[model samples]
Target: MGNAAHEEVIASINSQISETNALINAALVAGTPTDKLRKKLATLHGDLKTAQEFEAAGIADEQAKDEAFVLGAGTEIAASTIAAVNAELEALGVVCRIEQGGDRFAEVAHRIAVALRIHEKVREKIGEAAAAVERLETRINECAARRATITAARLDGKSSDREVNEFVALAADIDALNGLLYDARAKLDGIDDSAEKAAVERLRADMQQLVSATLIEAVTVHVAQAEIALLDGIRKLHRTGLKHAPHRGSTPRSHYLMNADLDFFCRTGALR
Candidate 1:
């Protein structure tokens, strides 16, 4: 399907899934008959499978592009200029880190340049992390819908053999999706500098303190630290791929809470 059509189908299916989940929730609370709920759930599963297939297809293309971009970015950064990094940051809505001093201007610029180099180097990992999170979200939503269907069936108190079988299947699906979501989140959290603002504040404080005592020395040290921090961010991106970082876990049942941020990166030219 063309991109527009694909998006439209996805939107329609998602709306249906939402409505189905709501129906399942109400049916469960009201103790609807297992057979009746099972029929509805069967339809929901069919739609969900279609949606999953579309997502799978899109992921194939996206992954290919991601691989190419990452490799190319690595090469580009090796010889990248400050202007290139500034352009990239501007595209990402990040302010360029340029120094406004006399003698330390070049040093500060070099530091920012290197940091952006690291940023470019890890760009693909960021894209992959975003994609993984999207996949996890879709799976989790589908599982939740399935879980609601199973719950509705159980509420009937006379679930048939088929319903029982489906319940077991849903259990396994939810378990697998939960694991995927956990891994996806760990990747994101590992690379996330959610504490970046605080870190910057500390650095600013230090720079101010050293302005009088040891101007050039403090600026050099701070620039080095900035480069090191950016390098560490890149290291974490690779380590996330190794799956060695601590798994702090995904968000709550409100999975869409993170999708907005992910969508921003995916939809914007950030991935470019």
Candidate 2:
């Protein structure tokens, strides 16, 4: 299949996935008919079938790629949900630290408000964190493309400008991220457990290495975080092996309630 076929297949499969997820939500929560669940499942099956055919005809080896999409959406959703849980737990911890129980002087509502604000900041940070990972992926892709070696003519493909820009923008604040982590480590230093501090250091080091490719470190980080973009799919489909950084755990699912954000907007680049 040509590039047009590949793009169209991607578009169609993404649309089907989005529509099916919407149907599932409506059935479960919106008082839709009971039979709609089966209809939605059938719709998913059909979309997956079409996606598989497209994979087989156009891409060289697509089983992994196709399954990766399914697995990634699932992973992204599960992981992001977990992250949110962790965030909530942390907020509760903060609340506990502050709510020492006193007269109205304690101002419990004020503490709650502060916690909520921090929660919002953390949410933005998670997006920022995901953005950082996306940038690293772009750099890796650019490096790979620079070294792109096509041994045959018919198999030729190149990176698109838009893809490069989008991926890079997601990771644009790597340096600021490093600064934030460093400050966290400093604030928590000497007061927290040494092991926890050590863990923070390890994370800081890994993130720095991911951003700094020219370093002579003993290890290189593979990108663990990525968006469900077509360029990303193409990268994986083309066998672009990542050696560092897995940011999948940092994804936020709240924005993609019902997984529509993950499927329709993210995959189709309609709301990117």
Candidate models: Cα lDDT each: 0.60, 0.47
Scored by lDDT, model 2 comes in at 0.47
Cα misplacement distance, residue 228 of candidate 2 (Å): 72
Which candidate ranks first by lDDT, i.e. highest? 1
Model 1 bad stretches (over 4 Å): 1-111, 153-160, 192-272
Clashing pairs in 1: none
RMSD of 1: 30.8
For candidate 1, write residues 39-85 as lDDT tens digits. 77688778778877887788787667656664554344323433443
Tens-digit lDDT track for model 2 on 78-195?
3443344345545634221112222221232233333333344345445655655555556555544433332122235555556556445535454455565555444434232344
**Lowest-sum lDDT 10-residue window in model 1:** 249-258
lDDT at residue 166 of model 1 (Cα atoms): 80
Report the C-alpha displacement of residue 114, candidate 1, in angstroms: 2.9
Predicted structure with the largest TM-score when compared to the true one = 1
Model 2 CA lDDT for position 177: 52
Prediction 1 TM-score vs. true:
0.30
